[model samples]
Target: MLVSEVPFHYKRPDTIVYRCIETPRNRWKTKPTVADTILVVEVVSPTTVTADTIDKRSEYARYGIQHYWIVRMANDDGPAVSIEMLTLNSEGRYVSNGFRNRTDDYAAATDTLTPFPVLLTWEQLDEGID
Candidate 1:
């Protein structure tokens, strides 16, 4: 949503698309053709986990958003869970790309990925987010 307010130009092999609209209802909108190869992340909650894992999974597949992630946090100490990454397959199903516990580095998920090349970690996320 942060980036949607800005206008930009997207060029494809056959088209030079210009998007200038602002204040759109759904800022996370993605085109079906390119959405299958894009990454999407959503913070998970007790009520939302099921939807994120099942409902949204299907929706993303329908829309063709290839990669999706659900980050969950709980009170248990077994694992300071923070992040989960899902990658879409040719069959339109998402597969677990990675899961990071409290101390694990999140940067690994960004390698070789477009629009997300920076490294992140649970420690960094928890430091300020609580």
Candidate 2:
């Protein structure tokens, strides 16, 4: 299951992926904590580069969220966006796994280590945005 803008341990991530069983039941009505999260994604805006790239990166890693993705919007150069995929290493730090740009013909997939593979494309992400 995926949720958007839901609070976790400290801050609300842009999006989060978790097993349906791990999420709170409807009546309990609570958000998943960092421990329940399998993946967390942050969309980077001009003002959020540092917070998403550095601050939250370390925070999520420390909290043991296994996967993190950073989505960067298009700049003056073009309408192309990019997604940077990261995985937690044995040292409890995030390492770059893959990066996909809008101009690329192929979508990016999560590695086999993840519970399931997710296919991401810039078009899918940029939909509904101005």
Candidate 3:
């Protein structure tokens, strides 16, 4: 299951991928530890670039989150954004899987690297925004 802005210890990531039973509790009362999370995604903004790319990257790796994805929204009118995939190594550090950017070739932007492969277009990302 996927949840957004869920608490993981003291940090609340933009998105989280976790395993949940069909009949999960009406609400999860406690924070999920690293063991409960499969992946965490952080959407980068101008003010949070350092925190997302460096600080949170280290913190999430230290916590042993299986996967960490850093998303950078593009300012131009080409494609929506780019994603950097990081996987934890045996040494308890994150190694780059690769960076995926949506180019003119829409088919090439497919998310085959992540556990969840749903494609998100710029329109879907901009929904409900001011």
Candidate 4:
């Protein structure tokens, strides 16, 4: 499935999450469950700072999302992508895998990895809507 800003959940109906689904299935007719998601990426915003860092972190773990990625754009001092990767542990909680921040080469860092190759760069993500 190739969609943007779509809702996903089973038990929690009131809360809706929109992720950059790396590989959504073609037959999906409803919201994606954790099983349906191989990888999840969230672009952090001012309004969602807490939600992305705290609330959603725990929620996705509870929902059994295997891999979670948070992308934060750099401010005035630099133009870069800050990526935080989390892997779900056996205890159903997330443990930090590390980050690809301003000084790191975004593409080289995430291009080759397990579950899914992110294959993303700060420039592509920062491109203005045409």
Best by TM-score: 2
- Models 1 onward score TM values of 0.57, 0.74, 0.70, 0.64
Which pairs, if any, clash in model 4?
Answer: 1-24, 1-25
Tens digit of lDDT per residue, candidate 4, span 13-43? 2223445556645665455555556566766
Residue pairs clashing in model 3 are none
Every model: Cα RMSD to truth: 9.7, 5.0, 5.1, 6.9
Rank candidates by lDDT, best first.
2, 3, 4, 1
lDDT score, residue 11, model 1? 17
**Arrange candidates by TM-score, highest first: which order?**
2, 3, 4, 1
lDDT of 2 by residue, 58-112 (tens): 9888888889988776672334477788989999999888877666776542233
**Per-model C-alpha lDDT, please?**
0.53, 0.71, 0.71, 0.63
Which residue window of length 10 is worst by lDDT in model 1? Answer: 9-18
> Which of candidates 2 and 4 is the stronger one according to lDDT?
2
lDDT of 1 at 31: 36
Per-residue error (Å), model 2, residue 99: 0.9
Model 3 TM-score? 0.70
Off by over 4 Å in 4: 1-31, 75-80, 105-109, 128-130
Error of 1 at 59 (Å): 0.9
Residues 55-116 of candidate 1: C-alpha lDDT, one tens digit per residue = 76686666566567766666532223766667778888878776665655444423334235
Clash pairs, model 1 backbone: 107-119
| lDDT (Cα, 0-100) at 65 in candidate 4 | 76
